[model samples]
Target: MSRVINTLDVALVAAAVIAATSLLSNDYYLRIIFMMCVYYLCAVGMNVLVGYAGQKSLGQAGLFAAGAYAVALLTTKTEISPWWALVLAAVIAGLCGVLIALPSLRVKGPYLAMVTLAFGIVVEKLVGEWTEVFGGAQGIYGIRPISWNEQPLTTQQWVWFAVVLCAVAHVLIRNLLHGRFGRALLSLQADEIASSSVGVRVYRAKVIAFVVAAVTCGIAGALVAQQNQYINSDFITFHLSIFILLLVLFGGAGSMYGPLVGAIVLTAIDAALARWPSAQHFLYGFLLLFALYAMPGGVTGALQTCFKRKPKKQRLSTGETPKTTRIGPVASGDLLVVEGVTKAYGGVKPAQNVSFCLQRGHIHALIGPNGAGKSTMINMLTGVVAPTSGSIKFLGQEIADKPAHEICRMGMGRTFQNLRLFADLSVLDNVMLGHHTRMRNGFVSSLLGLPGALKQEAITQARALELLELVGLSHLCEHPAGSLSYGLQRRVELARALATEPQLLLLDEPAAGLNPQETAELGQLLLRIGQCGVSILMVEHHMDLVMSVSDHVIVLDYGTKIAEGKPVEVQANPRVIEAYLGVDDEPDASEIHATA
Candidate 1:
């Protein structure tokens, strides 16, 4: 499917270029095409940040201005040629992007948008006021165009270069988004907590995405400046940023061909409305409203909806023999050790002085009533929540202060009590994301679609399919994870977590929404996984499953450990019975038997 789309896109771009250059004689229409090329570049870059990473940036014009000014100033003030200026433009803009991304790490949604919007306004005002370097509101004129054979290039020649640049940028962006980096971005978009739990460095990936977007915008800005031979403060504004954003949203933010198609259509609309300048804004507002109402997924998404494919009759292959699937070698003792761990929120402690050791190749169950701190202890071990006091050692190393992703990379994988599957992504994609840390490819390798990255991707895909088969959802591997039943989603989440191939698996209510049969199957699956040398630490309410599977059990009540023993021993303890049912009330025989 993806190959077909890529071929179609290449054919469309080639056909459009040939038709526009040969059929259109009017310079006005030709100029519009040139501007569309520039907008295509901006929209493609913005799509990466907005569509792929799911970060909102309303200040792309600021980055755009930085690029334009870089080229304009360097060529005018120094000995640098336009070519050198263009390169510097991208670097400068990418640096500016880092400035915004740094602050964005602390904010999201509208707050982040406001930050970028303020940046765009500031850039515009600074350029308008700074007369010495920027030429103030008057701006710079007579900037040299790109040259070939030591001869200054014309606008027509510049337009061809712009088209070529857009094509190259599109291919690179597509490759980057389809490979490991793209998968990480999609995971970040779905759920940052889940993404981190799978060993993805969420903030770092976002920053890299913004930098890529900024470089592309910078390239577009440079192209526009050279083509016009003039650049002024009014050209790059907050309004321009909004226009670019509209193009991305209206064209389908995440689709490979959406941005370019949107650029062509919107640019033409703007040109047609040039005679009635007042109506342009009104029409744009109307089009945005219509797009939201009629085509929520944008044009490309709508087209996909119109041409959706039928489900394939396929099943996951399952001929391989099971073997020890090891993440890394562990010390010959407890896989995890927690001592005197405490967590507090404003004098209220949800977990206090919790201590437990999970031996290697054993299933250790942590059980407690609601709000008994089982979840908190699990969070602390996984590094999702920090301990206010005490220590946590995993694989013979102290990881009390490590980040969640670092802990994950250190051979810990966990599932959420509330399902955290990437709702918009496919079952296979969700599982493939588990191997993110295992992948060794760099951004350039991913963008170039190198043999190494492609090979790694294939291996991950086959492994993910095997995981889906293990969980008995192999037939639904291509379906969206969110569309599955709650039980199925849980299984998918487990498959995704297992993709990490952790030495220790942390299952938080793994059988939460499952029926008796499903729960039994899950128990059998866990035992199978444990046989592969993986240790399990589970927090479960299903006493039958816990008692049947756990080698050891720790009981918690009111934020502290009350009993620790084998399941039967813990069940027989008076304190455990008192914690579940008050001393005045006798424990039910069936309930006691359930724990045995």
Candidate 2:
């Protein structure tokens, strides 16, 4: 059904372009149509980076120049065919994308934007000042245009060619962005830490997004140069970069049709404003500001709001049991071993000399007062924070220095102390993202939407639905995660973590915001999970839930382990009492337990 819809959309676009080409005889209208296709290509790929991945870039013009210049040099100087030169130009621009993406790993937000802006400035200067190769201000002339057989394409034929490319690009990009890869990008935009916890390689995903944007923008640049039979540094400017960004923002960033909408509407507006050169910059600036503040989601978003439909309530059938499956590597006895872990920042130590072991199929609780480092310990176990000195062994493999995504793939899953749900995504999508590493399909398989990829996606969705049922959230699976109540959002996070199929689960304050009744339900849920052969380690402040569900308990005080034993033993320990009450004298056992 989705394939049919996608085909219909492409067909409609092609039909419209064909109709316009048949009716329009003027060169100006034909050129406008051609430029719209080019800009749409750039906008669609930019949407993947700036829209879905949330990596703001301001140097795409540099990548555009990389493509445009490559084609100009290749067709003018070498014997390479214009078509082959176009492909090579895309490859060259993709490499440039990698160069720009390196800084993104170390910087973000305005700092990352500045880095890309500098790159554009450098490329502009290099092209404008370098005389021998780039032709300086004189620019490259008589560049060969693409041909059909032995004859160069007419203006109408060029428009037809661009329209076909746009159709193909739309189909391919839609396929690429609909499944696992799309969810991964959206998850990264929502929360990088959470994205890694769900098995997304953070840096790798960013690079792929940058490459996607670069390749499409490169194609657009190559097409422009080939059509015009000329290339100049004057065409590549900061204004071009800003204009490309506006294409995404004004049309609706992450929406599938945003590129087409932006390209058509803004291209027409630009053509209309072309006569008033002095007002063009001012109008563009005003539109950009309006898009940012008034229509943040862009034109598509506003339309969605105006025509939104009410979602139907959905639920699992009565008495249907959720299927339970073994997650991670099958192991016996101890599943996680932490030895003498210490994490210190300057004179402040969050965790010092913390040591503990988690037995397979057992539920262990880490309990502490405020600032006792329970969350820090969980962070270290999940590889979110590197310990100053420690050894972490999961399933007998040393993983102290492994990245978070690596640890997750090794069958460790965790939830944050604070909620980190991808708010814009549906609850089902959040869970499906957790199954990212488990899917067997490669990038090519996913990009082309092969049968294997489709099958795996179906299996992932089925598994996610079952997990939602297990957590009593199947009814709300279609709703946005952020729209759910606090307790429901917690359940969604748990379901998402469970989808990772981890042998060991580390939960930080899972019961923090729940009422007493909800806390009890959560205790029961943890027990059910433990019975499925998964080891559990939770950092929580609710003593009632801890006492009821914990098989063993470790208590922390001022960055040090104060007690480790059965829950009853830890609850009655004098040191634990003193740590909680901050008093030298031992309190009554019941009083200490109540205080905790």
Candidate 3:
């Protein structure tokens, strides 16, 4: 029923846009509508880059120019039909986008913007100066118009075609962004580090976004080439790129239909202000500033908020059949080995020659006072930080210098001490990312909602739901991770880590902010996890919980391992006591035992 309503809404919108064209039959008004369609198409592409991938590209005009010239050069110099030339223009521009994205994506923020800016200027100058290839500053002239049935299309016919093309672009963008690939892009935008930890290849996602945006802008340029029936270097410039970006931003970067709304409103405003030419630029800048200040989420976001729909009540379900899937190779001995692992920043060592072994299907705890490098050791083991010396092995394979995502794919999952959840994503989505490594479907399959991808997605979702239930957070699965309380967020993070179905779980400071009651609950949770044949290694400061759950314990002080044994033995070790409480007031075995 909801899908039916959404489909009806879309149909109504498309019909309205098409109907507007008929209502305004004047050639001038129709021409304005055509320009809006072109801008809307380009804006949608910009939205993919700026809104989805969180990339700032100032080279959209270069892509637009490439498309326009491809059309112009092909139609005039060769005998290619205008339609074929437009298709070629999109291909040429998309390739150029790939070139720019490869290098630009390596850097981020202002550096990336500068790279794109330079590319746009270079393309503009090339078109202006390359006399033979691009017809120099004058550009190509007498470019043939796009035609149907071997006859040049009239203005009205061309306007309808542009509208249809814009509609198609909208459908494609909406479909592409309504799946797993879209969530991955949003995750990339929210937090690159967290996204990578969940097995997202940040570089590849960004490049794909750049390519998509470039193609759309290129197509828009081709449409413009058809409309003008001529081309010039002056039309494609850095200012045009800025205008395109502004359109996406003002309309709402992340919202579907935001580009359309932004394009129409901005173009109409600019056209209206044309009579007052002197103040037009100032008014435009002012309006942009005002919109940003008033609605950080953009026009679409503001409208959504004003007309926000009440989320349906989601019931929490605790009962489910447990799943049994081994995360790594079945082994009978120790699951992990760390030998002479040393991590140093300059001359200071946070972890010095740390040696430990995690027996399979057991709970091992690392406990130490502040500055004991417990978190650092966890980082080294999980591939978040590289060990300066010595070897670390997991599942009988050395994994000292591997990247975080690779290690995760190899069956090591971990939660951060500082809580690195995707704040903008729902709790369920955050957990879903942990299953990304296990997913087999391609992006194309996900976008098209193929049966295989849908089946896998459903399985992943059910598994995530089970994990959330295990963590006692099934009720908050749809909530934004950031909105949860600190203690609750910790549970959500744990659920996400478990979603990877890890053979070894590395939990850092899981009890940091929990109350005594919550701490007790966490201890039971860990015990249940261990019963499932998953090995547990945790860095914690909560002594009572650690003593209650840990089968074996390692004590660290000043980056050095002082003791390793049963929890009771570690508690009574003289060196561990002295390191924790100070040499002047060391506790005896009996006193330590009593305290425990």
Scored by lDDT, the top model is 2
What is the TM-score of candidate 3? 0.92
> In every candidate, how many clashes are there?
0, 0, 0
| Per-residue C-alpha lDDT of model 1 across residues 91-114, encoded as one tens digit per residue | 999999999899876898889889
> TM-score of model 2 relative to the true fold?
0.97
lDDT by residue for model 2 over 253-370, one digit each (tens)? 9999888899999999999999996687888898899999999999999999999986678854474545665554556798899999999999999999988888987899999899
Per-prediction TM-score to the true structure, in the order listed: 0.95, 0.97, 0.92
| Candidate 3 C-alpha lDDT tens digits along 1-596 | 33335545666776777777767768878878888988998999899899988998889999999889888888888998888899999999889899999999889899999999999999989988887888776778888888888799877787778877876677667656765677779989888877777777788888889888999999999888877887888888777887888888899989987898899998888788768855766766776686678776789999999998754568755545344444434556888999999999998898999899989878999987789899899888877789999999988889998887888888888888888988878899989888887888787776555677767778889888878777777788888889889999998888888877788999998988899899988998888777666788999877888889999999888898989999888887888887766765665654543332
**Candidate 3, position 344, lDDT:** 96
Total clashing pairs in model 3? 0
Checking candidate 2 for backbone clashes, the offending pairs are none
Which residue runs of candidate 1 sit more than 4 Å off their true CA positions? 1-12, 15-25, 316-331, 584-590, 593-596
**TM-score ranking from best to worst?**
2, 1, 3
